[model samples]
Target: MSDIGLFEAIYSTRSMRRLKPDPIPREVLDQIITAGVHAPSGSNFQNWGFVIVEAADDKRFIRDQYLKYYREMERLGSIPRMADIPPDRRRLFEAAIHLAEHMDEVPVIMLACTGTDFPTYADANNPRSITATLHASIYPAVQNILLAARALGVGATLTTLHYFFEEELKQRLHIPTDKEIAGLIPMGYPHGRFGPTTRGPASDVTHWGRWGEVGQEV
Candidate 1:
């Protein structure tokens, strides 16, 4: 394991988009993928796949599509201006813009996908919506990937903007029609430092037995 302790990793594993062009070690990549597969799944059905992309040609294709949609979103006023976000998040927004511009240069990209149609256990209006549970089978694995990457001192960030062209992405990558891409994770050495994330104190967000109870800090 890395010198970084588990709690430290959790606190310092910021979503890092400003990454160096250095390649991640093959062994390290294998470790991260192994970590992801170990994550628990509903009913022990690990219906997830991780598609790793490193070929220059593939990255170029994905990057072009990402830029096309990002630019269109920005022009349509869908992507908020950095100045409009809170001060604490301005840096993150700036980093996102930078990533969008240089995405093709990143050493590796991983696409997390589900292998089947979303499982439905209830009507759309059910208090616990089926849509919410649909991701329960895969998101734990995605979180495992992020945490594992950080443990290896690899910089990474989760993105879904590519979903704007999901069908196109599948066609370009030859991803099976039954699979749904859940997230895109770009990984490399960080050009910037890893640090604690900013957020409201735990006490402010935690509750007791009831909602809005605002109990003591966790």
Candidate 2:
């Protein structure tokens, strides 16, 4: 129940990876999920599932798995080295590493999952057949959760690193076989401050009537 305006929340809500270990109140967590559930879904299916993880043992297991897979990916050259990252984006890279190193310290980890029954027209031969529409159904709710966390002064970031070890995670958490995890968000009080985020102007990427056209027509 923050008095902050919606646009203000939207503009200032950066992905906060450096979070404190201090526990968030249950009511605040409830509000965040409530906001998530209020988001729209395709065909009004609203077939989303959220798993809020707070147990220390569970967090530790997830953290270990994340680090293990992260290092493997790095070894395979899937992730760029520190020297390879652009100077302007290195901070984000560093922050992500920091989170991976200390993910267990984060207070709450929310798993955003989607039921598999949503209809799709993707070709069966395509590897990414279900990905596009499946994400379309769940990511809005994830965005809502992030915005709600920001308004409530909780730090959070959407991550999909868990996807690497998703099957094990589902087994450990007892998630249904028919659902797929879309995003994993770690939430807590921030170790840093929330501020305005930098981004290119919409007009820079916006096109009207056709591609490569900038600016709007009156």
Candidate 3:
């Protein structure tokens, strides 16, 4: 395990999309998944399922699907125009595009999934039937995986573009029908450096005892 402090890990973890093609060691991958499973889940059900993809064909398929959907979104005007994106964030946006184009070359792809007995909100007319809280069970584990990867010097980014063609992905990957993939994280050694993320002050968003009750900065 890394000797880095907890807060240090939390603060410096960024969505690293540009990664080297070098394969990560199996032991390191095992430790990263172990960190994910250590995270708490609703009712302690611990129902998350992870799939680590290393096959060249599988990565190529995923990359093709990602580009297909990305192009469709662009055609539909769902994605913001280049000029609309803020100057500081344009680099990140370009990095994401780079990832999409070269996703097949990434060394590892991890799918963080959850089991579902009930129909998802997308499939059902009544959103309440499948409580939004269902996601609460899986995202913490995803965050843990990201933090662990950062601490171990692996670059990873959580992406959901696959959801656009999720059924095809499930069939291609042989994921169970009962499982829903929440996040697809491509992982490997970084082509760049890990550094602190840029964000607005937490005090600007934090409310005290009640809504509109702003508190002083910590």
**What is the clash count of model 3?**
0
- Across 77-174, the per-residue lDDT of candidate 3 in tens digits comes to 78765677889779987888889899999999999998764434456676655555457778999999999999999999999998898898899889
Give each model's whole-structure lDDT: 0.84, 0.89, 0.87
C-alpha RMSD values across all candidates: 2.4, 2.3, 2.9
lDDT of 1 by residue, 14-126 (tens): 88998888988889999999999999876676878899999998888888888888888877888877667789778777888888888889999999997554454534556
Clashes of 1: 0
| Runs in model 3 lying further than 4 Å from the true structure | 118-129
In candidate 1, how many Å is residue 40 off? 1.5
Worst 10-residue lDDT window for candidate 2 reads: 120-129
Model 2 misplaced stretches (Cα beyond 4 Å): 120-130, 215-218
TM-score of 2: 0.92
Tens digits of per-residue lDDT, candidate 2, 1-218, equal: 54689999999999899999999999999999999999988777888999999999999999999989888887888887788889988998899888998999999999999976556543465545466767888999999999999999998989898989999999999999989989989999998988688988888888887898887642
